[model samples]
Target chain A: MNIRYPNGTAYHQSAKRPATTMSQTTNYGDRGMSLEAELNESNQYYLNQGVAVIHKKPTPVQIVKVDYPKRSAATIKEAYFRQPSTTDYNGVYQGYYLDFDAKETKNKTSFPLKNFHAHQIAHLRACVAAGGIGFAIIRFTDDVATFLLPASFLFHCWDDALQTDGRKSIRRSAIEAHGYQINPALNPLVPYLNAVDQLITATKK
Target chain B: MNIRYPNGTAYHQSAKRPATTMSQTTNYGDRGMSLEAELNESNQYYLNQGVAVIHKKPTPVQIVKVDYPKRSAATIKEAYFRQPSTTDYNGVYQGYYLDFDAKETKNKTSFPLKNFHAHQIAHLRACVAAGGIGFAIIRFTDDVATFLLPASFLFHCWDDALQTDGRKSIRRSAIEAHGYQINPALNPLVPYLNAVDQLITATKK
Candidate 1:
């Protein structure tokens, strides 16, 4: 029943922040909240306000053994991951099936291609083919900046990596040009949905 | 990482059945494939054909202990469910956010309301309010029949339970009248999406 991080830190839901100009004074990296945590909180806000119905898919685990110590409670004794997951988050937005993964990188110049897996790439491709909106939310942790990179552009980079012995990362410059930059806000925090709106508009063209 | 069921049976992906009318000869329940498994196969079929993108959310497990004997593999030693989950499956289908759960019951006359949790009902309501398509796929195991019951109708029944205290379960006659019956098939197995199409059309009307 008690959930903790690998380091044994108890995982408490992130506290709601005041909608004010605390961004200049507060160091977000030092705030102890991860990009995933912030996104979850923002999704909660969206859900509560009837704006969107998005959710982070749970980490899939294959249960091996269960101990029924009591009739009421059964505890899992052993398990392992079934496979590498497809994406971190997916749901409906304005009748669009949105599929995306959020990744944080310390590298300043480029987002490493190695951060993505083949399975995830394939899953995104499949989603896009099925008329779903697919993208990656890349957060350059060092600069506290994030970009919403469309899956179409990402596939191009992925294929380019396979065809040639070029850099295995999408350069920061390329991301800035092709992806929509997401500014942090008080209420929604990342406000990545704004970027999604732009992407939807761009697709219409 | 071998996975076996609680009864110590080895887990195997449900085999693709031949396109034959074996319903009269073959006993599906005895074939060891649960309704969930059938739906998974059907979803896989949909994915393979580039029809729609749907996935069953993985069961959320709160890991209490993990053994990292090797750097490559980590085995969860102890864990438990954090909370009751929302629904079994959710994804985007042809520009619609599809959210639903699959349930099977032994009762012949009615599909018991007790099969659904309060949290799931609330989750469905929230999804529907956010413009997502929500429903339940109820299977009568006695007759081997499945029906898609829309969230709108489900909410009415849920509220009726609270107010009038009528029969807690939806009578089989009511489900037949309000819900779309899904005929089992070879390629998609359950072919529930056909029922989804019906639901979509009904909503349009």
Candidate 2:
């Protein structure tokens, strides 16, 4: 299975975090922005410049219990994943539809399939089938290299690894072969739309 | 001008408090879920059922400064709105590409147009011109109603409001006349597809 993570950075933070009621004082959105926040800023830049329409998909949440601590009652005691989602960000660019996931990895060498679940792969597959442009933005924070990889490549890596689990990660070299490297700048940390243009160009050729 | 909340029980605290950082945490998915969360769940459910292939359009975020709370900084100290979004959700369903927004209001009588930005209305017009299904989900919490108002209805309201500082809200009566009411259900509270079916059916006649 050929999986690729440019430089390999942390993509998605772990699903679990410190309990909100336990010691939930930190306002993460106000201080630490997620990939969603960054991409949102980038999308705004693109919109102002008339580049593209892109957005982060909201995390799927299931509500279980509500405590209503103070008339607001209904606090969630427990609820779990309905299923893993397809991609992170997606929208329209130059009249063509686009979809992709942004992931960060602490691992410097490669990106693991563990990062993507089976349902998500199925989703990407369906998106591609529907004639949408699908890809991923992989960040290797250690080296600060982000690459845009096509969904097809993701599909291959995902499918192959199902049988044998040794080469579970997509190496840097494989990423170079199939993905485009994106450099961070003032806006669109991963200026992925450029890669999207190249992808559209390459596909046309 | 018209809009309607066919499904009683607008978006409410269906989501248990205080709210988790990520993931759907309970059996109740729509109530507590943010507008974005509900759309994604519905989109995926639609995609799986072969009903539609819609997605949430990402917001444009402007990242001003990245605060290094620590070596592994998880805080975004400064940021601002970069660009206005065109729409909240868009996708291809039943051969027709659709775009819309899902909003909830504590008010029961009318939905405030102020809730809708100028750019979203512009985007919806363009989408309608391009031959896509464009509408909005207005959840009136006080009345426990949700309406699938056509984009045209919103434009009319917007235009009228411009004429007079009279009001910037969509009256419930107008919504009832112009928009189709969505009956809430367990599977898809916003079973907009059924409404789409009726719209398609009406268009044929």
Candidate 3:
């Protein structure tokens, strides 16, 4: 089906339909959507269900000039993208502050640490220190497998990367061992909050 | 002295220095800044002190066209402002999810309900429902007084406004009765977190 996102991007959903009557077991795969698009759809589902209140922050832009015509809406004539100072997505979930960024990599064996910015890591560290739950939602595009890595683990790996003899990227095996795997589902696409519940319970312990 | 904001707006701090040696007794007043500027300064102070991790979401804009010249960054040629779907500011403070927006009005007797958009009210209601502390920092520009009105009280006022015979605005007297007043300070500009601590204590009660 043809769909248009709020930003006016044209998206086409996969036409392949499940043959059986069972809907719960149906896997949607990636469905030709970016990781961000999937997360947006998932966040919308959660909002509608009153399960949580999360949203992806808009891309920051620096506007240099605008044209205000007498009878029309003001139009930005010159602008440029600006580096964000925090994670891409953050909100409240069941009295816990949720903060995270989504990253996708095509590498089959590892997720590169260079995908994250220094400011984002600092911001997440600050959030975690202030008693908020922070994490990274990583997707391996080769197989569409996703994982939620807690900020504490990410911080350890990040600090290791800064060491003189540390490896450049985190190994997939290490991520699978330390992170919570989030399987793609029929509803909410990426059911990551189920994993967040685990993190909260573990934190309490 | 002329100071430039990240957005390139020039701001001038009041040159008149506080004569008293007691800094705690010093009131900075508005300091010739917008309510947003004061809040930004306060949030920075909190961040530096590791007290809270709050941030104002960037203004959303819809980009229609862009031009990418060689050897330089891409420039937005056409764009328009998009209405935000949530509160302007949110973060975690002492294990509690805090969500709020800042508003200013010059009215001497009452604060007009028209200053708020329906989506903002709905968003605050949803955040509060999700067990987050939601509020609005309202500044009366007439006397430079500010107050923090809780989402529960705002919901009452919003619903009352919807009634056929209800008043369209909240009187200053009513706000002073229900909301916590925030006095300006030299360190953070707006020492609003003291008021927030009170809100948390009351919530626990």
Cα lDDT tens digits, model 2, A1-205, are: 3343322223233334322323324322223345556677888787666666555654443434333467552334433333435567666666566777888776787888788877667766777766777888877655556788988888888777777655788987888789998766677544778888888899889
What TM-score does the predicted chain A of each candidate obtain versus native chain A? 0.85, 0.73, 0.86
* Superposed Cα deviation of residue B11, candidate 3 (Å): 11
Q: Determine which window of 10 residues in candidate 2 chain A has minimal summed lDDT.
A: A5-14
Per-model root-mean-square deviation over C-alphas = 8.3, 13.4, 7.7
Write model 1 residue lDDT over B8-121, tens digit each, in one string.
122223343333412334455335578899999989899888888788888888888999896678999989986745787887778788999999998989988989899899
lDDT against the true structure, each candidate: 0.83, 0.66, 0.88
- Name the regions of candidate 1 deviating beyond 4 angstroms: A1-30, B1-25, B28-30
First chain of model 2: TM-score?
Answer: 0.73
Provide the TM-score for each candidate, comma-separated: 0.86, 0.58, 0.88
Q: What are the chain B TM-scores of all models?
A: 0.85, 0.74, 0.86
Pairs of residues at least 3 apart in sequence or in different chains that clash in candidate 3:
none
> What CAPRI class is candidate 2?
incorrect
Go through the candidates in order and give each one's DockQ: 0.58, 0.07, 0.67
Weakest lDDT window of 10 consecutive positions for candidate 1 chain B: B4-13
Q: Which ten residues in a row have the lowest lDDT in candidate 1 chain A?
A: A3-12
**TM accuracy, model 3:** 0.88
Best by DockQ: 3
Candidates, ranked, TM-score: 3, 1, 2
* lDDT score for candidate 1 against the true structure: 0.83
For residue B199, give model 3's deviation from the true position in Å. 0.7
Q: Which stretch of 10 consecutive residues in model 3 chain A shows the poorest summed lDDT?
A: A5-14
